[model samples]
Target: MSRESITPNGLNPDRETIQLGKLTVPRLFIGLWQLSSTGWGTTSVTRVRREMRRHVEAGYNAFADHYGTAEQIFGGFRSTLPDPKVVVGATKWCVFAQIDITRSVVQAAINERKEKMAYDRVDLLQFHWQDYSDRQYMDALEYLQEFKNSGDITELGLVNFDAARTDEICTQFPGLIVSNQVQFSLIDTRPLDGMGDVCNKHGIKLLTYGTLCGGFLSEKWLGEPQPDEYGGPMTPSQRKYLDVILGAWGTWPLFQSLLQTLQAIGGRHGHRSISNIATRWILDHDFVGCVLVGSRLGLTEHIDDNDRAYGFRLTPEDNAEIEKVLEKSKGRELVRVLGDCGAEYRRGGGHE
Candidate 1:
């Protein structure tokens, strides 16, 4: 509702930007993981292209993808843009096999990502290691550091890595790692437990996801009854976050209470939505460089609503009200169960 000047990309002139290594990107990144049609519902290529354009037009110039088909889809669309250089691309590589740790194999993986994404060099290349027990991840990072030195990768990052491991890596490579992508929403503040401190000490930033809890944090679920198992229409992301909501966050009824509280707080700030408030809450954190919101592309659109997040600031009373509800929630225990950021995925179970 604020009369802020709009940029050509549809971004508010006041919207902030962050430095991820050498690339400067918007604080809100369009998450392309939904582009992969395996877990998330089907999405047409046309929709994907349109959605990317929508984000760029709206002033969100950064996109994040994993090393899956998402890279291919995003790259394919990016090539068609009038000015592709305006977009900042970040992707992840999950090390699931021992071969991926070797220098030759790692180089091949990098080359494959470049070819698949149709980019000469990736702005940020985040690595995800399933088995921390294997020291091959260290070797992989060493190789990635070499690539970063040679300019094949603009920046090196980590996905779902814990604070201890992050610290170890920082000690090993100093300023090579710029960011760590993790799930850090109001419902899951695991990063604040220790990861935040580590990042602060090491000058590393956090790019957070799961902030909206796969749309559950939105107003659509307000006052709704808990869906019976296999009864309600839900996407894979919703189902996965539902487990987190029910498991460590709180019961369904309590979640509804929190949603109602968010609605009330948002109303005070020019009638913002629950999702916007949830995202704004994470963005307010000093350690967070950006928040990644899942974009379902053509199936659903919330660009206007999302833009509202940066329109107003949350008051201290708003934080107090949210915290009052959180005090009764099981967030601490949830962090314990989930371990550190990205522990669910490493355990062989998590939202895709």
Candidate 2:
């Protein structure tokens, strides 16, 4: 499709677009981790497929998935869409198991992911290593680079990788890595400390998640009482982010204050929702290439609110309002406690 005719109905005019190798994707990607059914909640295949089609129709051409059943689920959904080639898919290869880092093993893994996703090639293949102590991940990347050169993968990306390690990888490989997926939000700004600079220096972009803090940053939780117990009717994401809010972010009262501030700012901008303001804040960051928004598929819909993020820009006064509250918050110290962008998962704590 020509660039002029590529715009979809209801697409926000101000939404930025970026080029990932040869694939051009919107600044916001539809996240499919919730489709795994292990964390968010139970999802029906029909509902998930319908939601996927809706996102693509809305011009959210790029989608993110993981190794497990997410790729398969996305594959099934993609089959139902018209001209699936227009939709860009991204999946990860988890390097947790100890396996021989041979070229054959790596090629087989890549082939398996492609076959499972019903695609000859993936737009982006992101690598996630649970234990950085192991050196097998480097070998895996070496093999992936070969595939990238041969056109099996369009781009290579990393998940939860720190600044120092990312720089080392870039230095050793030159221009192999194009992007890094990390958690970046109002509550978690660890990426700004070092990762941002390294990515900027090396021409690596960032795809950020957890910007909404698993719905904790939404209007639904504003002024609401904190849950007394950890487990209840809350989804796993909600339970996990709640911990960050209480632990890293600070007291519920302070969070409520932040929420009100966002609401007021959003009100000035066509009465946007809290989630819209939160997502727009992340998109405003220079290092961020895209913000991954978790979709519950047919379970719920936020297409309209999400589109609002691109409708208006935040002013300096608005940023100052958020900063004023953050100044008194413990988010900075929380970054230290959490270690780095993907440190929580590596250390087996925090929300992964």
Candidate 3:
């Protein structure tokens, strides 16, 4: 579809957005979870700044990050954008509260992060509860809630909360949570096991990661051996997760067939890649405010290709064809085998 004929659903949707409380963010937000980390490359601040300029020029307004240095990366150059409108950012606090998450300590961190990011307030500070057993969870939530209520944060939410626990939190603090980040993607539909319906009922939207399954669902991985050889001596989180999906989806040959079907339909739509099809398929699944597609900073930029997803919408026939392929192979039941959509943190005791 031509840009002239298509309607943009987001900022440029050439970027994208969703309602995070009162704040609107790009539909396809730039994820910085791996940025500033060495696994991908030596991220130079200069290069990262340039990437942000290009990304903003493309219309993507949100950046989600986790590590301490993440704030530093975006914080270093706060005045480069167009009137603080280029990007709306979100970062996570890994739920490692020390005994009591003293308000002074929490406020100090927020101030530091806010000052570094060059914003009066953070658009969102995602709360990550590593373990439900920790008593500090309450203290942390209290302070986080205080921040949200006082407008230090545009909004506050959780990452990877189980359905049961999510219900408990909402009951404890009514009408406060605007969203929850989860692992919703082609391979992980675990949230649909009643969580999404409940979210709709209670007014919470879901921000999903792994939507592309670490490139496994793309054309490149369709017919390959699933890369059991592991990219290096130290396996990556995404690669390992893809390996598991491959196991669940049967073998490489079956996945290849699935990819081919997507390719055929995608080709019909001028996309020619399964990744675009997979992304479009999720847009209307309900309660999905947006999907988190990561940025490798220096590795690759798919911003232009990602824009393809917005110009078109999938059809019933399109979904049926995709499902037919999915039926042939095993679907993602890893959440069942592992736990709820994001119950991995509690089970594995946080990321390795």
Q: RMSD for all candidates, in order, please.
A: 4.2, 3.2, 5.0
Per-residue CA lDDT of model 2 for 78-109, tens digit only, reads 66555668789998876766677898987887
TM-score per candidate, chains pooled: 0.94, 0.93, 0.88
lDDT of 3 by residue, 116-223 (tens): 777888778777777678767767778878887787888887888878777778778777788788887656678878778768877888888788876666877666
Give the better candidate number (2 or 3) by lDDT. Answer: 2
In TM-score terms, candidate 1 sits at 0.94
TM-score: the better of candidates 2 and 3: 2
- RMSD to native, candidate 2: 3.2
* Range of the 10 consecutive residues with the lowest summed lDDT in candidate 2: 1-10
Q: What are the runs in model 1 whose C-alpha is more than 4 Å off?
A: 1-10, 349-352
Q: Candidate 3 overall Cα lDDT vs. reference? A: 0.71
Residue 44, candidate 1: Cα error in Å is 2.3
lDDT per residue (tens digit) for residues 217-305 in model 1: 99889999996546767777788789888867889999998999999998888898999899999998888999998887778778888
